[model samples]
Target: MKQRLGAALAWLEDRTGLVGIVRTVMQHPVPPGATWWYVFGSATLLAFLVQVVTGVVLGSMYVPAPDDAYRSLEFITNDAPAGRLVRGMHAWTATAMIVLIGIHALQVFLFGSYKYPREVNWMTGVLLLAFTLAMAFTGQILRFDNNGVWSTIVLVKMTSYVPVIGDDLGRFFLAGDVVNASTLSHFFTFHVFVIPGLIFAIIGIHLYLVIRNGISEPPEAGRPVDPATYRAWYHDYLRREGVPFWPDAIWRDALFGVLLVVGLLVLAGVIGPPEVGAPPSPANLDTNPRPDWYFIWLFAALALLPPGIEFYFLILGSGLFFIGLFILPLLANRGERSWKMRPWAVGIVCVIVTGVGALTVYGLQAPWSPDFATQPLSAEVVGATTGPVANGAQLFHEKGCHYCHRIAGSGGQRGPDLTTIGDKLSENELIWRIANGGVNMPSFAGTLTQHELREIVAFLQSRRSAPAPAQNVPTVR
Candidate 1:
């Protein structure tokens, strides 16, 4: 039996040369010091494989039509066999892939691995990052829920901020002048087919480059890259101390990849998928749509940017950022590779990570959005139980004023807290502001009656701090 099996294997190898190819790849030499930092790239590839597997399962069950997409998702979550777990795995793995790819990019940048012959590798990585994010955005819209619908609209509107081709771009994304039946199908095609195809192609090229150029060695403080001599030096260096990739360096990548997969599975089983929101409804005025966590930083930035320069910042800023990423190796590919000698690189990474982290936290709180779920202030908190003050307090919530303005710490922080407005503004001033409105506040002139206006003003006027105790004065001798 052993002789027969060996003969069959030899026959296959002779016909295809498959054994030699595998042996060559597995026995490829890499820098001996290439440690756990090198594992992230392979780990990211593992995460992407998980995404592909789970996404295929989901795509098989999800309906691409707008009318049925939400219902299909509900069915998959509640009724299908192990559907929820698979869906959770898909979502969590997408998150993991983004995080891993980001870390891998940062590692390469910090190590100066993008220098010399590896410039194409970095450029391919940038394309993968862009495509990964594009996949995420398109996937969010496939939920077809209230938040998803509104998010699509918001994205379309933002696209409309571009100069000459803005409207055309918006129309193209929507598949028409407005989001309709075709919109879901368009995004579904992008999420499941188009973006994934692009990613797969780029990933193939990236891997080819890695094998062709060889992995970069761990940076030494005194070593600086010189393009003219880098290839020869790298080959000689590898010849001196390099180790086979399979049994030596590949073990760390394999171990980390397994752990990452197990962690994602545990998370998926424990947490399940994000809850599906209400079905899409244009009439749902109270909806406060937000992007998923990965995109919240950009959302916060757009919300916080000054109105005058927002358009320029959105268009020019994003374009320049991506352009800069592609041209980075060209700018300074021969610099000192060690972080110890590149303080500016460390500072740039620190600033970017800090800024994104802070923005994400702020976006989660979303102080700028109206709090539609805010309850009416209780009579005790309002300091009134009857008459115009009490009635006005009730009206405050009924009229949706509490949604944006905080009074007794029970409302949103979008507008100014009006807890002590009476102390700052006169009755006339309050009336004018409320009647005509200012800035983000809407006009209540036609909405409120004269009696209601007076009642609200009376309620505002009653909100004052307690008077301070009288102080004793010193007498002159």
Candidate 2:
């Protein structure tokens, strides 16, 4: 049996040369001292493979039609066999791909691996990163929930800030003047077909460049990359100390890839997929749509950026950032490779990580958006059980005042805390403010009747930290 199997294998190899190609790839020499840090690139590739497989499974099940998409998601989440697990795996692997690719790029940048012949490699990597983010944005919109729909609308509106083609871009994304069934179909095609095809092509180029340029050696503090003689020096150095990639370096990558897959599986089994929000409804004022965690930083930035410059910051700022990434190798292709010798590189990475981390935390908190889910103020917190003050407290909640204003520490912080409004404003002033709202506050004049408005004023008048002073303070407005 062994002789027959060997004969068959030899026959196939002679005909196709597949065995020779595999042997050549497996026996490629890698630089010495290429350690676990080098595993991220392979791990990222593994994550992308996972994404592709799981995405195919989901695409087979998901309905792209606007009317049926949400219902289909519900069925998959609740009824389909192993559907929830597959969905969770897809979501988690997408996150893993982004994170691993980011870390891999940072590693390459710090190591100065983009220098000399590898400049194109770094450019391809940057394109992959951008494509990965595009996939994430499109996937979020494909959820077809209210939050997803509004998030896409918000993105389209932001796209409208681009200089000459802003409006055109927005219309293209929406597939018309407004979002409809076509918008969903367009996003589905981009996420599943268009963006993935670009990513696959770029990944092919990236891998080829990796093979062409060879893996960079661990950086030494005194060693600086010089394009003139670097390739010859690299080849000579590899001849002296390089190891075969298969049994030597590939083991670490394989181990790490296996561990990453196991970790993703565990997370998917334990946590499941993100909860689907309500059906799409543009008229729903109570909805506070937010993007997935990966994009929360950008959401926070757009919200926190000073009002007038948002257009510039959103357009020119992002454009410049990406432009900088693409031009980095051109600007400093030959330099000290070690972080120990490049303090500015370290500082840049630190600033970016810190800024994004801080913004993400703030976005999760989201103090700017009203808390529509806040429960009504309890009777104990209201400090009244009956009469005008109590009735006013009930009316306060009924009018949705508690959603924006904090009272006794239990409401939203979007507006000022009204826990002690009585000490600051008189009854007439309180009445006037409630009737005619200010900037962030909507005018309740048309919404509240005279009696209900007075009740709300009474409730506000009862909110005081201490007794009023003997001297009467003048009211403004």
Candidate 3:
């Protein structure tokens, strides 16, 4: 039976030349000293495969309608056997793919692989990156949770800032001017099918370019890439000292790929997926919707930007980023490949990574998140017995002051802590700040009644480091 099967396979191979094609791909030449750094691209590809398989499994059970989507996901997460694991794998792998792709791109940039013959490869890779992010964004909306819907609302608002045809694009995104049944369906279609399809096609082209151009030789100190002579030189260099990609370079990639998949599985089993918050509720003013971790930096950027210039940052910043990436290969396509010779490149990378890291940390803390969890100021913390001081503490929470101001380590950090606020300001100063807001704070003059304002101010005056007699404040009648 084995002999017969082997003979049949040989016959099929002879007819189709599939074996020859596999052999050719396996034996493709790679430059000498191709080390663990080369494994990142393969790892990224492995992550993409994980995402595809897991996403398909998840899609089978996921409902795309706004009404049933959250419930269906809850069912999958709690009722279906192994469904949580599958969903976790998909979510984790999406993040892993984005991170791996970023590292791969950074590797390419640092090694100067985008120069000369590999320009198109880099361009395809950038597009793939964009498509991967698009998939992530659309996938977020499929969750049908408050965070997801709010993210879409934020996205639509941002889209509406585009210079030309902004309204049309925004309307198209929201599926008829608002997030409804059609909105969820639109995102579901793009997430599971359209963006992934584009990624698949672009991956094919990216691989074709990689094979045609050959992997860039590890950067040398002084061997600057000259477009005219580099190709012939690389060919000659490979002929002299190249190894078959299958056994020599592929072993590291295989080891890394296996470890990555295993790690993802372990993470899925341990951490599982992000919590699916309450179903979409546009009217929920308390919702502090945030994107998944990879986008937290951008979310932080939007949050921390000066209030009115959000559109400028959304448009001009994004425009400059893509423009810079597109023009990179054209600007310095033939130059020194060594990072040692490129201080400006190193500086740019440092700045971007540092900025993103800082922003992500801030986003995680989310100081701007409403302090709905803030407990009312206790009498002990307030050091007050009665009168306006006690009423003021109640007014403090009632007026949403706790949402922005921290008090005795209980409230938010958006505004200055009022734990020892009495040490910093007089009653008049407190009243002034409350009546006239500064920067991100909202003024309460139009919103608060005179008695209410006095009560709030009385509460602020009582927040002291030590117990003290309440000041004899005149009653605001």
Candidate 4:
């Protein structure tokens, strides 16, 4: 890094009359009036660096299967020694990166730094902000927790507005009825590589443009070079005010970035990523789910809405908002750098910020969810019947209970592991279900004799208290 920094500084100092070089932009030998506030961009760049490195580390450890996902995360957090460190760094850095970007963008916006030649820069920035948030949302759900699942549920429904393609889109995104390995892998690839790749290209483009068009300073005064005569560059300009990009630029970026990483590490050690209440199970239809904080507002918004009107407006509103956001650069490409004259453009930006902020705040505070978490396994859960649950036992095996629920650690996860069924369900609850079946379960009443239901109920619960083996060894002295 030091060698690269040296080479970059040499290259910068060698530029031919590079008037827009960092040193010149500062005004003083150091950008005369430039305040530390200007460092927001530098800080943002640092955070991005953290995201790339940390995300790669996280990707290395993460498992993309929905069923295995919760366990994989647990392993990352609790079992794999470095798993916690890697995941913690990646998760917290991601959050910090977005926030830093937002602060940078907002600072520039408020200061009217994009008034003239910087409009394109600011516009590109806004798009970047959206991308940052997009990655955040996708990464969060890719966790596939009870929260992740339900968050996707609400999101899928919201997307129902993509004409007739909505359902297909949702299915495609989820990789099936619920999030699956495909969803995890897809999101992982996007989060760690694809999106970051695009972001990198954008960063290159954004920086190159910054170089081409001189940095925009506050509305203060300067030699108002007519854009036509301002032969842009700084190689020669270095003799007048330039500093080596080594100790000057790269050093600051690296130092601050390290500080940010250390700070986030401490935070993660203290707080940790919020754990989900439970892993999602489609078989348990009544589970109450919510999304992570970044999305709490959206969840809250969905709650506030009177079902029909709320979704319709949200769909339409979000679509139009994004469309407008993407097209803003072209719309403001008049190429003017006069912040004083760009009230309307600035206003548009403020409007977007305000609207998004208000919605986020509202969504976070609103109370909107099912009245009851798990519908109490409704009395109708299994339905009217008195019978031997032994039939239910046969039904269990026949219906693939063993495929998902485990007597111990043996079974598929197509549903929740049922090793502890007795701890939760009563005999009546078990028997009623055997006779009638509930939720994803098929009714055994019509197929099983009353005695069969009894036997199966007995069979399913019997394993709960299976005896422990006698001790084999004593504690070491």
Candidate 5:
């Protein structure tokens, strides 16, 4: 045992020291003309650093309980000074990381960087992508809003499409039938710990490969060199390609990184974190409970398909997608490197992203229903007079009916306003009109009693024709 330990110590001494290690790996050359493209991996890694730091800050303030989750988020967004800024940066920069990593992968693949000598890099990259997506999914669920629960329900149903283990997979996803605090707990663990750990491992391996292979296709590299025989570390290595990490590439990446950071800060400051919805309500019944804009397209697509298809569309479609992603790379010829040579492959990717973008945009602006605007206050016609109109007035504003419609310069402009409505009709005619709305308004007669209907008409009349009440107008000095 002592002899073996001594031998191992001797091997370690040979390669472990600072100078010896440096002198060792410089054996391989960097890509001859290293450009912005070469630094993609570095940028990706830097973005990861940002994510980890930002995530830690977020976890510190966020609560995990049912009652506290929404209120805590409200505090972070509305009360905390820079909380919104931090949240936006965390969210939007995650988007930037995905985009940067994807482009970096494309650049690597396009330049033949994935050749035999650098296959390790390819493997590590694929794993990193999987980790990145996993982190995204888990982080999204951590929001714990109406959309979050709905997204989880929809995704679990989709997961149930797994062939032999379908039911088991669904149960595992739900951790039971419902997404309670436990579901958030599951997501928090995977997002904050497990997935991040796996990603770090993959990223470390990827960096090792880059250093091991010397940035793949340095312009000077012609014939492949033996990996075991690579040499020339500290002395010639730094002397040749040792660009100081700070000023050399740091300026470019740091500039963009700062831009990303500042942009997120501005957005967060301006918009704040997304408004916390009414606490996780099972009956909120937001028909189009779409995820954030990033995943809106997927949700819209899922919604667009025939409801009859059930989960089959999700399963078969996703299965076919991964099948293509993994197997399609093999079709490339040995020497194919240029993007032009892979027209079909590139086209397919473009189409997928474009379709997703288009669908997301469409869903955001799509009309949910005809009766969607702020519903006018309902009142009853009683004693030949509209009932207490202000009661209906209070309900109108209380229900947020103004979001999609206008009323006496008070609401949104999407639907008609009631500024001059009383000029056109008498009380009885107005009642008839209210009962049968034109295009967007819903009939209140069914939903409101005669007294309630009268109150709403009085409210509308008060807005359109009545003199300005002394209480409403402030006197000027």
Candidate 6:
């Protein structure tokens, strides 16, 4: 049986030159001292493969129609065999792929690999990043949940801000004026077919470029990339110091890729996929729909933008981002490759990472978005049996104070927590702040009756309980 199997394999290899193809790829020359930093590119590719397989499995079970999409996902999560696991893997791996790709891009940028012959490779990478985000957006819509619907609406609004043919593009994205049955089908087609096809094609081109131009060598001090001489210099360097890519250089990539897959599987089994929220319904005003974590920075930025300039920022900001990316390689095709020597490169990266990270944290806390979940203070907290104080407590929620101010952990963080507001402010000061809105806060002088204002003030004045001592909460940075 073994002899027969071997003979069959030999016959196929002879016909197709499979062994020779494998040998050619395996024996490609890699620069000396290539290290684990080089593993991220391969790891990203592995993650993309994982996404393709798991996504196909998910597609088999998903229904694209608006009415059935949510139900179908629920069935897949709760009833189908290995369905939850596959879905979780897909979700987790998408996140991993994004993170890995960012790291890969950052590595290339820091190493100055985008210079000279690799300019096209860098541009293709930028497209891949955009496609990954597009996939994330369309995949969210596949859930057909409240967040998904809200996101679709917001996306259409965003598209409408595009210059020139914005209206047509927005309509095309929605498959109509608004999200309906066609919207779900449209997203499904793009998520499962169109976007993935483009990603695969781009990946093919990216890999070809990488192979043709060869892997960038580790940056050396004073070694500036000169477009005129870089290719010849690289080829000569490779001849003098290169090693076979197969076992000598590829080991780290293989190890990292395996570990990443294992991590995804473990995470999927332990945590499962994110829960499906309320079904798609515009009437569900109580829902505070938010995008996935990767986009929280954008959400935070939009929330923080001054009202009048929002549409302009939404349009111009995005346009400038892509324009900057496109023009970068063109502007500086040759430069000193080391980060230590490129102060501007280091500064730009630091600013971007810091800005995005800060925004994501702000979004998570959600100081700008209204917290509709704030409930009235309990009788225990108010310490009022009846009459004015109790009425004041009731009036607080009725007056929408709890939406912006937390009293003893019962309200939103959009404004300062009113848990100990009475401790810091006298009754008159409290009344003044309430009657005259400060900054983002709304004034109640006209909106509230005199008696209602007095009652609310009385309620807030009674909130004098001391806060608990702070615990040691870990800080990110």
| Candidate 4 lDDT, 60-103, residue by residue in tens | 67777766777778877898776677677777877787778877
TM-score of 6: 0.76
Off by more than 4 A, model 6: 1-18, 282-286, 367-477
For model 6, how does the per-residue alpha-carbon lDDT over 54-76 read when each residue is reduced to its tens digit? 99889998999977988899999
lDDT of 4: 0.60
TM-score of the candidate numbered 5? 0.64
Candidate 2 stretches greater than 4 Å from native: 282-288, 369-477
Q: What is the lDDT of residue 324 in candidate 6?
A: 79
Model 2 clashing-pair count: 0
Better of 2 and 3 by lDDT: 2
Error of 1 at 414 (Å): 6.0
Task: State the displacement of the C-alpha of residue 396, model 2, in Å, after optimal TM-score superposition.
Answer: 18
RMSD of each: 11.1, 9.5, 9.5, 13.7, 13.8, 12.0
- Stretches > 4 Å off in candidate 5: 1-29, 218-255, 282-288, 327-333, 369-477
Clashes of each: 0, 0, 0, 36, 25, 0
- lDDT tens digits, residue span 1-477, model 5: 999997887787777765455545544334333566766677778778888887888888888765677777777766776777777768776887787888887777666556545666776787787678777777777777666665676677678677889878877876765566677777778888899999988887887777765554442223333334333432355457655443554456666667756776676567655655544431232443456676677766765777547468868986776555444435432444455655765786688768877888887876644234444443332112323655657655554445545664546553456666656566776676454332223333334567666665666556546554657421211
Q: Candidate 3: misplaced stretches above 4 Å?
A: 1-6, 282-288, 371-477
lDDT by residue (tens digit), candidate 1, 327-355: 99989889699989999999999999999
Question: What stretches of model 4 exceed 4 Å from their correct place?
Answer: 1-31, 164-168, 176-178, 221-258, 282-288, 333-362, 365-477
Clashes of 1: 0
The residue pairs in collision within model 3 are none
lDDT (Cα atoms) of all candidates against the true structure:
0.82, 0.83, 0.81, 0.60, 0.62, 0.81
